[model samples]
Target chain A: EAGVTQSPTHLIKTRGQQATLRCSPISGHTSVYWYQQALGLGLQFLLWYDEGEERNRGNFPPRFSGRQFPNYSSELNVNALELEDSALYLCASSLVYEQYFGPGTRLTVT
Target chain B: EDQVTQSPEALRLQEGESSSLNCSYTVSGLRGLFWYRQDPGKGPEFLFTLYSAGEEKEKERLKATLTKKESFLHITAPKPEDSATYLCAVQAVFHAGKSTFGDGTTLTVKP
Candidate 1:
């Protein structure tokens, strides 16, 4: 089966700009999760979406937000991006317990 | 709060050498513990999931075992291709959909 897939392998944006990253979950999966991995750091949970509803979010600021569509795809939007926002953003889809990840989108903010 | 901690930030092993990576976690209610392998600049690849203590799962040269407070990924007779960062994550029963991940253990196997 095809695993989770993300678009825009790499994205570059300047500070104060907005960036959008997209993810498509595996077939038959309804839960999509977003995470950020900064260099030398662990994965920080960003948001969780199930059945097109936002279930939970991490400690990130309000400027970091996202939504899940009816088809179980998700989009992460970072408004007023900062240099600190530069990191690898990962998307995951869960069937039950185990989550399958997609090749992350690398966002570089200058 | 749910938290996951992985130890021995890095490890170097010669081909055929065996070792183990540790993941310690604390959560309100344990739902499942997952192990994943991640290559540089790539996403995590799921390996195994342990739902309860004393659970064990194996694939190829990797064996994952779970305990009450921690889990271990044992690599036996590893190859150079096994080199990558191994990540551990835990989902709390209450949280349902969210998981907390560890910083991960970087393993380097040399021929």
Candidate 2:
């Protein structure tokens, strides 16, 4: 079976713009999670979507949001992006316990 | 609040060296502890998951053991390819779908 897959391995956006990152979960996976790995910030949870509903969210601002589709794919959207938004956005999918991660999308805000 | 702390922010070892990394956690109830390896420009790759204290798992030259309040990743005989950042995370029963991750320990293995 294919592992988690992410689109546009790298992305570049200007300040105040918007960015979108996509993720396709593995077959039979129902939960999709989004995380941001910023410099010296460690890995910060952004959002969690399960069964196409927003199950839970992190402490990030409203400008950071995401959604999961019927097919178990997810999209992470960053609005009003700031230079601090530059980081590697990771997507993971799991059933309940273990989470498998994708290659991640490297977002660079200029 | 649930928290995960990893020790020795960095480590260096020669090939065939044996060492271990530590992960200490504070959670109301630990549902699972996860270990992952991440390269410089890629996302993390799952290594192992320990459910309860005294549980252990091994693969290749790596062995992961969990205790009541912490976990240890032991590398029997490491290689240069093992050089990467090892991250530890914990899922708390009360947190539901969220996880707390440590800053990670950067390991460097030289030939």
Best by DockQ: 1
Compose the digit string of candidate 1's lDDT tens values, residues B1-111. Answer: 999999989999999999999999999989999999999999999999999999999999999999999999999999999999999999999987888999999999999
For every candidate, what is the interface RMSD in angstroms? 0.7, 0.8
Error of 2 at B102 (Å): 0.4
Which number leads on lDDT? 1
Cα deviation of A12 in candidate 2 (Å)? 0.9
Predicted chain B of candidate 1, TM-score versus the true chain B: 0.99
lDDT accuracy of residue A12 in candidate 1: 97
lDDT of 1 at A109: 98
Scored on chain A only, each candidate's TM-score is: 0.98, 0.97
Per-residue alpha-carbon lDDT of candidate 1 for residues A19-90, written as tens digits (9 for 90 to 100): 999999999999999999999899999999999999998999999999999999999999999999999999
**Residue B25, model 2, lDDT:** 94
* Candidate 1 CA-lDDT value: 0.95
Model 2 residue runs over 4 Å out of place are: none
